[model samples]
Target: MPSLTAVCRVHALLDDSGSVGVTAIDKRPVDGPVEVKRLGVRGDVQASRAHHGGPDKAVYAYADSDAEHFAGILGYEVTPGLFGENLRVDGLDVTGAVIGERWAVGETLVLQVTMPRTPCATFARRLGESGWVKRFQAEGRPGAYLSIVKAGPIRAGDPIEVVSRPAHGVTIGDVFAGLEPEQASKLLASPAPRLSEIVHGLAEKALTRAAVGA
Candidate 1:
């Protein structure tokens, strides 16, 4: 079991301060319990809704271990919410968490693992590091995106308990591994309804690649 170490959110900004204009990558920690809904954390605003904050990606979760790994690489201490993640969890292998896996946060809120967070230009600019997108991709520890299964309040220090796990072993890391055809097939065939759409998209990509090979 893991614990929620921090909860965060941010308001959208229109200024072109960072490399990405009109962004809300600057997330700050919020005190006490915060409401989690289908859209996202209450008060959290996504400037680029096209790429973030939808039903499938209602919440972003990152592991403390991953932050530590990045800290060792970047030579700076990475704090919770600094990566714009809505939840900072401790003692969870988020990369290894299977898609469609259900987690009970606190006593009421339930969340299902959806997809992995792919690094974007905004993420690179947040780090002020060049080639960060490539570096992050190569690292292959992209955090997990979660969809609210049972909307409720989540707060720091809430226990995260695994409620269910899909039989398919298509973990977030596997998706970050370029969604191989085999894994994609398994995910697509999974009985978990929450994973259907995501796996379908991956399966389509696999088909395209196979067609090209043919």
Candidate 2:
């Protein structure tokens, strides 16, 4: 694949479906660069399932795996899907990433893998259907949720590079694959304060289940 390139620009648009539904409205595919929008830096975008309002931390977009993949599968460069990404990397193997791994976008933007995205209520609404969350959970393709370690401006076409790998050899994908909400509670009761709140919550819930079984 291509090594790296500069992020040309960034763009944002309103979800015309009144509820920020999915569907490709504006994108460039032929003979030029495509447009990628930021998902959660605004007051309107939130993680809550209620249609209220919140910051847009996770952004969902259509798949653009390869030129052929887009053309054959998605029919375009930017199809409407679900993504909780701060930056829509053009050519990064995003799903293959592990937790605690670090990657730099452009030059100043650095991010660490915090968690794999769990589908929320708004996502189902956006997809105009239900049970989509179960589909993700079943397949283990929950995508990546990142924590911004160094805040920086990001844009489309920006080059991304891995700066660090996970120390535990556990990837973000693995955590998502293993997470059990009920059992996550016990993980929180433990003394591992160094873990992120979400991670601890998942572990604690799993631990609770184990205790009950024991």
Candidate 3:
């Protein structure tokens, strides 16, 4: 069964990475059930709401499989909250989750898969690895940001049910790795409301580049 392996929240902010004075990337797992609101998991706050948290990015999830893969490369254990994700999912392809896919978390909370996370310098700083940003980007399993549709309490070990998905079939992996021209066309034409400005820009760029080269 696909389940929420961990529920993480920010307890303290990490010192500035560069220009940003602080980072909320250092998240830790909580003991029991936690409330999930429209903004995000309760008690978890980003240092920069301007660049980070928003309605379309209310929650973030990273799959355990991806974390396991990273742990091998990093030569260290990638714990539940290491990636600063609000939910750590087990037995699910979160990276490949289709845009506009609706998930029923536990029972009450409903979430819509929005977009893939773009690696940032703060994320690199969190890893403290050389070329971490590019490396993460290259891996192309950056996980998925989610929009809260129905807010309620969620917890570790809660079952995850994918309730619906847009018919377009464009997945988060395709967007994160850069879509092909055909894939971009599908994404652009899809009426799914979950595609954010960033997602639109990426698809549009793909088409523009294809046209220029034609």
> Which of candidates 2 and 3 reaches a greater lDDT?
3
Would you list the rank order by lDDT, best first?
Answer: 3, 1, 2
Number of clashing pairs, model 2? 26
Per-residue CA lDDT of candidate 3, range 38-123, in tens?
89999889898777999888989999999999999999999998988999999999887998899999979999998999889899
Please identify model 2 stretches exceeding 4 Å from their true place.
1-44, 47-63, 66-86, 180-194
Q: Tell me the tens digit of each residue's lDDT in model 1 across 1-214.
A: 6999999898456465543467887787899989999888999998877787889989999999999999999999889888889999999999999888999999899999989998988888778898999999999889999998899998999999988998888889988887777777787677665563665687679867977988
- Order the candidate numbers by TM-score, best to worst: 3, 1, 2
Specify the highest-TM-score model's number: 3
Q: What is the alpha-carbon lDDT of model 3 when measured against the actual structure?
A: 0.90
Prediction 1 TM-score vs. true: 0.94
Given candidate 1, what's the lDDT at residue 185?
78
lDDT of 2 by residue, 1-214 (tens): 3233222211334354444454222222222333322332222234234432122223322224522342443244333222333234456665567555676765575656656666665455544445757755665555565555665655555567888874445555557777454424433443422455667566766776777978
For candidate 3, the TM-score is: 0.96
